[model samples]
Target: MAEYTTSKPEWAPEKDDENKFACGVMSGIDGITDTTVGNLNPALKNGTMKPKRKMVLSVDDYIKGVSSGDRVTLARAITLIESNNPKHFRKAQQVLQGLLPKTGKALRIGITGVPGAGKSTTIEAFGNMLCDMGHRVAVLAVDPTSSVTRGSILGDKTRMGTLSRREEAFIRPSPAGGTLGGVARKSRETMLLCEAAGYDIILVETVGVGQSETTVRSMVDFFMLIVLTGAGDELQGIKKGIMELADAIVVNKADGDNLLKAKVARAEYERMIEFIRPATEGWRTHAYLASAYKKTGLKELWDVIRAFEKVTHESGVFKRRRDSQLLDWVHSMIDEHLHNLFFDDPVVLGRMPEIREAVLKGVISPTQAVAELIHIFDVQRATQRHVDLFHPENQK
Candidate 1:
């Protein structure tokens, strides 16, 4: 054994230093890597992935999507319009500003009826007929949500299986989300998107709940109410307000054994409609019978819609009505936003418990409690404004 010595290798310290230096370089690189890599998780250096920031879609991007006829973008745009967030609200307004010129060109028809009235079947036939005539059609069906889950079945697509498969037709089912109206919160915006997408005919299908008829009526140029024949009530049980809003009443399911019954129902509805006020000047409210499943009388229905559109467009009533509706929508949205904000104030929310207790204990009347709560909110808002005005640091 030629002097088997246990001497440490001379390069051992150098090798150890090199390994340590390599580790240090890697650590340093990682420390600055997030800034260089772009959108990297800050927590990677701290042993976890950071949460991603939600994308803030720009108004320009949204307008481009609308102009480009991108359906997914249109859906997202409507979501933005319906959002209660201040940022999204402002962004949606900007998008609408860009799209205002392109909208109001399509014929908006609102169709509604009570459940089991064959509204979906009628809409399918109506949409297919429009498509056959070389026109693009969009059908928006608003489904009421289940009270337990607050989620709508959103099964309008299933009911409209035929129309859903059409290339020229776009069918969207939106949850009513407990909105009092049959239409969804951003349905008006969705209509604008459809119009921008080159749909000449837009049909708004409301919930068959009867309560939403007025809401749906106010949004469309033409309103058609579909009723079944066997009800025997004719227009008596029908709300006068709803009858007063209809441009036309259609008695569906007129084929097979129900033809005579449908005719009788139509005659009854026609007579009753005559007693109610007309929806527009020079346009008499008409009632007709049809079998949507059999595709009978759809042409006649289209003819009626066309006649109304022609008259309204030529008389300039269409443009005026659309403009007025736009204004009404603006005011309505403002009122809704203000109502939500007023009730959402921390001061108001915080006082609700105490206010309820006081009312229960008879220490204060409900009316007085409300007044006091309003006063508290007013003071809180005034203080916030004062602070915002005087705080130079905050202004900076």
Candidate 2:
């Protein structure tokens, strides 16, 4: 009996890991009396085993799971939204349609800054604080893709070690997927899903690249620009366009030796902010100092955000902006739809290579080449419409 004692599974990563799953023993193939036992087992002949299929969730399943605040279902629904497959697109749209009534109630905040500005650290610290205050926070971190491999590390969840472990926080680091500004194209849809899943605060952390600030600002109620001290002459270029879009400019790393520098930077930003127009109606933009590593000044930051929300809501700017965003979202979807339909047309595909070569070789100007492509694309569409209008099936 001692010789037959249970041993650790061979596949366990650790020798003493009690969580390792136990492997079940299979019965040998009996000659004729019980041929079904082990007869279909691939392991008996060293053949490849059949891979397990993932469970398919219907649109109703997604709606039910998300309505009940089920994290697994929320994640699955998000994956469906991110899918490029047509079937998934239809199903995800249906799910979103069903969950639409539950969305748009969350406070949507967008955070953007340059690289090394402690955006992830700030989000984690801030998120933990929010959770401590009994708030459900959803962090949508846009991860940039590698230029060579086109793959994203999606490291935001791992970076927010404490917040990711919190039951009240949901952190999703989605790949940019080659979209401009490193913002995921499906991020807006995912935010709605989180809202439907009962997250009251939606934090969107941009990739801090080109156009991300504007993109995030378009989607969120409050936009924050996180900066570091010692910006000096380098601040000249960055302080123009994006600064006008920020409701708050936070000078982070305000701890230890950097505290004084942070204060000075905040003052400088405040002075410069005076020259720029406010990002939102009936609100004044200001700069503050904070230290995400020390978890200091974050509560004040939250207070400022709440004040902004209250002021904006009272002034009717909040509802107006949301209405505008909804309309703009519709326009963008229409543009994307037409863009795909245009490029996917076989006539356009056939002419694109030649026109591109012409522009490259200087046979035609870039503008002229674009004009020619548009001309052909328009003609192709017209011809197809005419044919469809008179087709035998249509006549019947």
Candidate 3:
């Protein structure tokens, strides 16, 4: 005040000085200051933090993404193939056609066991070991769907936390969707998608819902049956057909108190396997003791797998198995499509309730009801074909 001059004083505040002060001189535990306040989120201030919008990609995009081993794109492709929408199906077909050349190069392994057999645990241990050895692994875990909701209760991801987070590992849990083969109806397609994505190994895990063992065996080049110690007799809940389908039977929980029991189980399984024919001509199904907790027997198990691959590949069984799988896949899809067509026809839809009641009331046999429905479906299909032939423009 005493040094007031004609020119404005240097201490005079500007028009927006109050705002600057509020930003820079906020109270703190130590003291207030006249320092410039910086943005906590610089990206947000610069409009760089906005999330990218997800868009439906084209077939070319999918092919590029999968070929480049992009996990996000690979996941999107799998979802598209698994979708129930007709449009998604068409798009997926295009994507698959484009990626076909890159597929059929991965080793497909099917893993299954009865409920509570530590199947997921063993797979996690084994899969991570393979990943550590520099192999990219993809796990297609098929969870059983709720009969009422037809939705999956996905829990495999949680069980395989470590492996699921690995950059070289991919885990997909698909709903079984009431598909009888113990796997999702689209599992074969999904495996091919994984193969196209450059994974070295594909693990197709089943729901272990009995009767799925054979189905998985048909699809995978190698089939591993995991069993637990002290789970009762050698063939307790597992069917004889399952033992016959196994390329290798591993007795899990082979550490701690269960060590001796696991060894006993292994011998018993070995004896049981001897009575059955080998899953492949040159390969003999043997039982091995494993401890998923301690991570023992994993390397040996992998060695066995590599040996089996080498032997089968040289003997031509590997190629033949894949060819047979393709045929099975084609027939399975055809059966599914025909079944869907028969049930989804408008004529059949309208008559289904009435037919069900008639069959339940004993007025018509189940076979007669099916024949009647099929007949309706055939008529409808024939009428549609006739219309398409006469009115070609209306086909689309």
Candidate 4:
């Protein structure tokens, strides 16, 4: 076979057009340049082993595969949903629209706690128990992004080793991506995908920073806060507003010597609950004791969740919360979209460097800097619509 060959494309206008056109002939390369890595890309030398093209799932395929509970396809569909690519965003939204009817069936629960509070351990135990009882559980951990590496470092699969292997369980760890919420920006969509995949229980584990987890509370039907036995954290939790947000306050690690202390901590939390308004209208928040290691109280915890679902559903609070969540989702997405547009706008980007330097040098106050940036962003946006933010005639 000839190592290299050249032929003008049929689409070329004429032989004379080759001299003027940049794209005329399809030049067959002999091989990669010696400067390139021959060891890594040996296929380029012989051209026998071509790189395989990616397998793309169509919208209908994604919908069918997700609905039929194909784990691999479901995982791939979730990857598509979490993708940052513009093209993927459109495809993902289409897939969600197709699967919309299949979603919203699962009971979504959000769990958060202070650091080292054994949230993962409890979730694993709880999830395994649910799996054994004929329930499908999906555990989603929203890991915090490293400010330096900007990567998701928390390994949920490794932490939930037992549950991850279960056929009835699906565990996905999502990065917060600097979103203020302890949950990922696309977590609501991910939860829907889990529901569509036949998972009846969706457990959302937040970044667990305590306060910011309120965002998680908005998406979940039930929100619970896990706290430790001591370290004066019970009072700290109340001060952080997390206690107010929680439908249940669980004092985990109630075993061995800590059992007595755990009971005391629960009493303190129960006392604090009396001063705070209930998280739900028709529900009262209460503190409970549990031990993840011994697997006690988990069954009771599930019973409480089940009872909450029944009570909220009957009282119409469940539907109202879901409806309110939908509205909040819309408002949040709009805020994020407009935020991205403003910061990425060419005019804003051009002026930001100078304004930032001025603020850093104390030449302008932070408030003044923000006002200037907002003005610039608004003016730039108005110009696109053939209007001016400060035209005298328009102002009148």
What's the ranking of the predictions by lDDT, best on top? 4, 2, 3, 1
Model 4 weakest lDDT span, ten residues long: 32-41
lDDT of 4 by residue, 170-271 (tens): 998878888776687888899999999999999999878866877998899999889997667877887888888899989999999999999999889888
TM-scores of the candidates are 0.79, 0.82, 0.82, 0.82
Q: Which residue runs of candidate 1 sit more than 4 Å off their true CA positions?
A: 1-58, 379-396
Give per-residue CA lDDT, model 2, range 1-396, as digits (tens). 011134454665565555555553344433422111213344323446652422466678789999998887788788888887555666677788899999999999999888789999999999999999999999999898888998999988888999998889888888888786667889889999999999999999988873446778879999998988885522552544888898998999999999988888888888888888899999999998899999999999999999999999999999999999989888987787668767877788999999899899999999998788787786456446444323545431
Model 4, stretches more than 4 Å misplaced? 1-54, 362-367, 378-396
- For candidate 1, the C-alpha RMSD (Å) to the true structure equals 13.9
* TM-score of structure candidate 2: 0.82
lDDT: worst 10-residue window of model 1: 25-34
In terms of TM-score, how similar is model 3 to the real structure?
Answer: 0.82
User: Which of the predicted structures, 2 or 4, would earn the higher lDDT when compared with the native?
Assistant: 4
For model 3, the stretches where C-alpha displacement exceeds 4 angstroms are 1-54, 237-240, 379-396
Evaluate model 1: give its TM-score.
Answer: 0.79
Better of 3 and 4 by TM-score: 3
lDDT by residue (1-396, candidate 1, tens digit) is 111123334544554655344322112232331121223333543447754432345678778877777766676777777675544555667788788888877899999887788888899999988999999898999998888898888888898988888878888888888887668878888898888877889999989676557778768999898888877546443554677778989999999989998898888887787678888767899899889989999999999999999998899988888888889898987787566656767778887888899999999998998788777776456456344323534432
lDDT for model 2, please: 0.82
RMSD (CA, Å), each prediction: 13.9, 9.5, 14.1, 12.2
